[model samples]
Target: MTQQPAADPFPPPSAPPAQQFAVPPPSPSGRWQPERVDPLPGTEFGLVQLRVMPITSGLAIGSLIAGIGSILVSFLVLCFGITGADSGWGGWVSGAFTLLSVVFGAGAVVLGLVARRQIRRSGHTGQVRFTGGGMAISGLVCGCAGAGIALLSLALALVLQVSS
Candidate 1:
């Protein structure tokens, strides 16, 4: 005798399927493309928005460079003077380094002050604000310190020279 097929427990629905989110097809190069998604209500996404960065003042950067150079050269002057090396150019080299340190220190102070003023003015004008206020202040401090060191070193050298 032939057996009859078992009755189906679950049958396909007659109604059409619900609508789904549309997705773009892959590119011809077989790379997956990113889908554009709308941000949720009342939410802001930085990636979808243009951002502006504040500009750094050039004078502030220059001040920082000069200040660091002054400090470094001041140390070299101190080392050369303290070592008491009797090389032919020892005194001249030390004097030159000391002079360079003072010059760099002066430049740093001037540039830092100018940069600070420019940054303040720009901030008050409601335009793009300039950054690096801290750098300018630091440069000023470093420049003053370097200049003081050079002056002290020169005084010591002079006193020692006179005593001998």
Candidate 2:
């Protein structure tokens, strides 16, 4: 004999097909429900925290110091000029100032070269953010100032003029 069709062929009609969306924690209204979603894929984001922000901070600092040193040398040069005219120990003082100027100038040049190298490196690595370039430029200023002062002082003291 053929069997009769069951009252409900489908599984006892359980809760709505495993709702992709799940019910939210019961709200005061008792009807709150939340929808499910998957996290965004492929698209990603990154931040450049710069563990050490490495554009040779010391080089920039050295450049800045050198620039300021140049201004100091210029002042010393003026002093040397005034002192050298009087002769005696004044000449000695002038010589000292001139020497100081030369030293400071050379230091600034060295620092500038270093800073320029750093700037190049930073641009290559893409980390430097704010002040290295400015400092390096200042170093150039310092070098020029120091050289001018020292040379001018030397010329005055030794009469190295072209004698035109």
Candidate 3:
């Protein structure tokens, strides 16, 4: 019996190897590297971008520093013996405390605004470092605000303490 070789089962491959060409890297978008960070890697899809500004970190740091400053100023006033309007030294103490409050309060406010700007510019999505920085800044701003509030509270407490 004549046995024909069993037909080959696999379908023929479609494309030849000669047609493939390596793809070049895309041009810079100007966000990550304005000039040059480093040479491009051989692989694709894992490059990180750095932003001009980060918002959250700013707020965090600013708030904290300012808040502490505010608290310190209030404490200084108390330490200096601020009292009812009867002494010249008391007026100086009050003025110094108020100045500290203003500086801390203003720093917090400015930092908060900066944080918001960074968030907006970066489109709200970024590397962990960038986000963390923004968050730290924000925390600082809040801390400052808290310090200012604490200063006010301390003023009241001091008055009560003196009265009692």
Candidate 4:
């Protein structure tokens, strides 16, 4: 025995054929209407545009690292008194390390300035959303402090020599 197709269980008594299952009209703007902006090539979805963006600053990071390292080195020199005048050879070694710290600090400040300049340029071009300007500035501050400390140490050394 073959089974026949079943009719609607509860069809409206006076409903017209076309209006029986009518779909609502589309709105003026469709649900997923994309903006009028032109889509970038190779993208199937026009909702988002892709572009290369710059963010990280290598120079700024280097500056921060160098500046902090210089401070740490100087602090170690002070803590250990590795350059104590008592030891003839230790004094020269300590002075050299202190000088190195000063140089590192200066380099950090210079690199930080360069990074900041690049960040500013990138910002103007709208290529970078965020920048490491704070890091660069902080590095500059540390560098100056390190240089100042070194100069003070040198001055004290000279004063002690004159006193003796």
Between candidates 3 and 4, which one is better according to TM-score? 4
Model 4 quality (TM-score): 0.60
Model 1 residue 162 CA deviation (Å) reads 3.3
The stretch of ten residues in a row with the least summed lDDT in candidate 3 is 16-25
**For residue 145, what is the lDDT in candidate 2?**
80
For residues 46-159, write the lDDT of model 1, one tens digit per residue: 122212346899999999999998999988877776665444344566788889999999999999999999888874322567999999998998898898898777666555
TM-score of 2: 0.55
Q: Which stretches of candidate 4 lie over 4 Å from their true place?
A: 1-36, 39-54, 79-83, 124-126, 158-164
Can you write out model 2's per-residue Cα lDDT over 1-164, one digit (the tens) per residue? 99988786566534433332233234576433333333223323222222223444577678668767766866766666555555534455656777777777778778888777767666333344334777777787877787787667756654522221
Q: What TM-score would every model get versus the actual structure? A: 0.62, 0.55, 0.43, 0.60
Error of 3 at 58 (Å): 4.4
Q: Over all chains combined, what TM-score does candidate 3 have?
A: 0.43
CA lDDT for candidate 3 = 0.53
lDDT of candidate 3 over 1-164, digit per residue (tens)? 99999988996656533323232244476434322233334433233344444324555556556656666665665555445334445545655666766677667667666665655555443433335444545545555664565466446545644564
Candidate ordering by TM-score (highest first)? 1, 4, 2, 3
Colliding pairs, model 2: none
Among these predicted structures, which one has the highest lDDT? 1
Candidate 1 regions off by >4 Å?
Answer: 1-52, 85-90, 124-126
lDDT of 3 at 113: 64
